[model samples]
Target: MAIRAAGEHKQRITINIAIDGLRLRDEKTGDCLYHHPVHKISFIAQDMIDSRAFGYIFGSPDTGRRFFGIKTDKAASQVKCREIDM
Candidate 1:
């Protein structure tokens, strides 16, 4: 998880994701389903993090999928939404 300094009034946050790059090799045929990367994977989990409107958002690569949620001030309880595909 990564935290970014967003606004002066509220705190902004972002997430970091890292997937397995190695391919699954077949036992019998010795076939590879996926190929691994030569170098370490480096990518931003969320492209955009804002609190100007309803909440914060992170756009997908194609802009078709989005992951977002609302902001909360209460420490005891918090409200957030799931990833919505648009």
Candidate 2:
């Protein structure tokens, strides 16, 4: 396997981002307890933009969970840093 850094890649990296609202239910009661929203962001390396996914970030569904902002910020930064300056 060949390893290439983001800056060394010939093409620009492409990222895929998705957000959705989900209805979570209890297994026993099957009752709709709460509505949760989730965000998923994945990175495709510049070299293998279509062949495979380079990395991914799965955001927490609950905002009350600590470090949510930190995680999201980190993911965003990673994506921004992957871009090659024009």
Candidate 3:
């Protein structure tokens, strides 16, 4: 855990993500199927003591599959604002 004071935000949290491509394989032939890119995100609290989550995202970026997507007025109103639990 790395801690740096940003000033005026005590319990501020940060989310770090890494996006990489993984090869998919076929079951019968054991051949490469396709390259799938996934996003892995990690959450860290400002205190640097308690960490929150480790999640993976595999979906369309424009539509924002499942847990993540663009937040617009329509989307925001449709979705509730709360802590994400997985």
Candidate 4:
């Protein structure tokens, strides 16, 4: 997944994910933005151990927030700052 701003002056990011690796590239020039290795986990036998774990924990598919981060607590503060700047 990637996101781009509207204008040429703006920057864009392109992210690629794989089983054992992840890479991010710049959309405009096809430059390597970032690269990282990921650990692969297999849950094939996990289903046999606990069938109930395969189902959703919260019952609702959309119950959780779309974005999560250490900076999530500062979201309101950041919005307030932007509002003041406006």
Candidate 5:
């Protein structure tokens, strides 16, 4: 029997990262199922030490929400939503 770690998601999904936001595209439909804007990307969560970020959170325990069209209350979280000059 193979042992599996908790919170280990092995689903193969296409991820597109652009200047505006990060998107999770459906392989079959070619439709963007999830979108996390660069501004609202609270913090990149790492599952293991020195590992790549597996979670793009919006400064909350809830993952079902947080998107581009969805307006997030910036004042509620510690993150300053001010845009940095590029």
Candidate 6:
């Protein structure tokens, strides 16, 4: 599923569970947003991005953190089932 937040600037993110690991991509330009091999992620942070929504903050500590602005449980479950830290 794509990321959506009401009253916010437009962004396109699609989450996928690949054989190698978790993948986040941009649908409009065919760019990979974030990708991590299974068991390589350092942490998963659950927090509010703004007043409008809450999502995940995940990445290896050495690489810094990245955000995935997911809006629903179903979307989160999709990521979790793939062996993500969250």
- TM-score of each model, paired residue for residue: 0.21, 0.21, 0.25, 0.33, 0.49, 0.50
Residue 27 of candidate 3: its Cα lDDT? 45
Worst ten in a row by lDDT for model 1:
77-86
Question: Positional deviation of 7 in candidate 2, in angstroms?
Answer: 51
* Best model per TM-score: 6
In the range 1-86, model 2's lDDT, one tens digit per residue, is: 22254446332222332245334345456666544344333222322332222333334456333211111212344433433211
Best by lDDT: 6
Q: What's the lDDT for all of these models?
A: 0.32, 0.33, 0.33, 0.35, 0.47, 0.57
RMSD in Å for all candidates: 16.8, 14.8, 16.4, 19.2, 10.7, 6.1
For model 5, residues 15-39, the per-residue Cα lDDT tens digits are: 6666787677776788888766777
4 versus 6: better lDDT goes to: 6
Which model is ahead, 3 or 5, in terms of TM-score?
Answer: 5
Q: Candidate 6 — which residues are off by over 4 angstroms? A: 1-7, 42-57, 61-67, 72-75, 84-86
Ranking by lDDT: 6, 5, 4, 2, 3, 1
Q: Over all chains combined, what TM-score does candidate 6 have?
A: 0.50
Count of clashes, each model: 0, 0, 0, 0, 0, 0
How do the residues 1-86 of candidate 3 rate in per-residue lDDT, one tens digit apiece?
Answer: 22344445223222221245444344456566444343322221121222222223455657554432222223232122221222
lDDT score of residue 1 within candidate 4: 29
lDDT of 6 at 41: 55
How does model 3 fare in lDDT?
A: 0.33
Q: What is the per-residue lDDT of model 1 for residues 1-86, given as tens digits with 9 covering 90 to 100?
A: 43335434433333222243323344456666334331322221222444222333333456443333334333212222221110
